[model samples]
Target chain A: MSGYIEAGYISVFSVLTLYGGSLIIRVRKTEKKLPDLTEEKKD
Target chain B: MSEVNFAAIPQVFSKRAETATKIIGVLALLSLIATVWLGLFVTPPDQFMGNLVRLLYVHPPIAWVMFVAYGVAFLSTLLYLWPRTRDLRFDRLAGASSEVGVIFTGLTLLSGSIWGRPTWGTWWTWDPLLTTTALLFVMYLGYLALRRLPGDPETRAKRSAIGGLVAFIDVPIVYFSVLWWKSLHQAPTVLDPVTGKTYIHGSMAYTLLLGFVAFTLLYVYFVAKRYRLERLKYLYDRVLLDEAIQERKREAADFKAYGADKKSLVPTAFAENGPALGDARFFGTEEESVVGGGEAGR
Candidate 1:
């Protein structure tokens, strides 16, 4: 309810969400640059 | 020249592991949401700390994951160093885990500071636990930086494993700093170190437990994703290096066929409508051209 409590929760959640989003974006970008080796492995 | 054997590159994650990572990620997100709801709306404020105690649900869990991440990195480093078990995969895991650990460590410090501001009336302190934790953050950062230094893969892995080992020496110190020294930072709340008893009970305990599980799952998910990224980057660099090597070899062959006289030193590919001799573009870049020219001259 207090500003400190709100600040703590907001900061933690924001850092985590941002980091998670960045990781997904990076993985997608890197996957695009390389051939899908997972498909190659299947064949 | 031989073909680049794409099959030779190992898979970063198996199909089952990939599926498991996704499941873990979803579970982490759901549980994290639940933890926020329960900690904020459902749980009662502490008798003494009042509303400030809500920070407990998140701070300790983030700190716990920080420790676990570093612990995983330490073990991976050791595995990488062992002769029989030595593998670059362990090095990659160590690097990835340490990177994630650094993030969690940062969050731990940030949240801890926020709590401290209200409870202790100061945003920062010289307390042993806090100082050691800050030190742990810097040390792992140094470890990550060490990994990024230019070197052959084996050399870099070995150097980074040593750096990781050095950084991990502070982990236990950070853990016990509260007990080992007089400090403002509170001792472990979930499990009393002296009595081995849990202090909190009821919804508070359950919510805290959920926070732990949620963050732990998040750590796993993060490490999995980071490890895949490291592997992809490694493979991409290898592919580039292989291409560069193959190109150089072809140029060398052409030079040999034409006889490396002063006038005919240029490879046929370059001699015909390509970049001029000494042109950096012919060798991919200025730096590579200098090195390539040195090798070709020899």
Candidate 2:
């Protein structure tokens, strides 16, 4: 944690993790509606 | 047929992405451990460069991955723009790949400058290879900007594909710049002419190879994640469009049902207009409303 990577890179990794988390949130929201659509089509 | 649904993606794809990610993580850990061991303790200090030469282990792989990333973007863009394969999935993939490529290229440039400061007595250089590599990175940035530009999706894809092809010329130029132009950089030294062998020590060579493989795994994982995100975005937009179209159809149906049961409130020029007007109501309710209002006033 302390030796190889520099302090500046902490910000980079933080931003990447935040970006990835937001992407997951977006995917989940879209996924929730998909099942509802399928159920309606089936009915 | 199997029920292939998009909602189940994270679960369905998790197994493969997880296995791949785990392997990548473990390999990266081992590579880092081995790199530190060999770089710090095992490899003898260089006579001229002192400890600065240790940066070689990081520099070459970052450069290699940067080149590979742009290569992926170039090939994917070509495939995307081909007349037979101009599908939306390919278009999104090209954009995503270029975005990832630009990130890696930025890392390469940053790490190179850091290493250069300690060894070359400067933070930057106008060397041909460095210049061309920088140009390639800027080209990828342009590729990303093309995606964000305002236009219809099809037009954007076509224009971006042309940009991709035009910018990719810098790739080969970056690769061969050392051979074409003399510079402060050393020529490829690992090449052995007579026995056709690179006499890299086993430990150093092994660790560098492992690092390369680990970085490649990381690259693949990143590209897959980006491509998946782009696909989901496309699907989400498509589903919204379909819902809008269905809502419009439902509204049209409701309008027809209302017209059939309700009689006209205003007196008509012809009493027989009831049946004829009904027919027009069903066939051209939207158009009839405009014409009927005009005729009634006349």
**TM-score versus the correct structure, for each prediction:** 0.86, 0.72
Poorly placed runs, candidate 2 (over 4 Å): A1-43, B1-44, B150-153, B189-199, B261-298
Chain B TM, cand. 2: 0.75
Question: Cα deviation in Å at residue B177, candidate 2?
Answer: 1.0
Clashing pairs in 1: none
Best by lDDT: 1
lDDT of 2 at A40: 33
Off by over 4 Å in 1: A39-42, B1-13, B260-298
Query: What is candidate 1's lDDT per residue for B1-298, written digit by digit as tens?
Result: 1355565455544777788999999999999999999999999999999999999999999999999999999999999999999999999999999999999999999999999998999999988999999999999999999999999999999999999999999999999898999999888999988989989999999999999999999999999999999998898888778788878999999878778575577666555555544567546654455432222331
Quote the positional error of residue B264 for candidate 2 in Å: 6.5
lDDT agreement of model 2 with the native: 0.64
Q: Write the per-residue lDDT of candidate 2 for residues B51-140, one digit (tens) a residue.
A: 655555656666677778778877778888788876766777777667767777777777677666666778789999778888989988
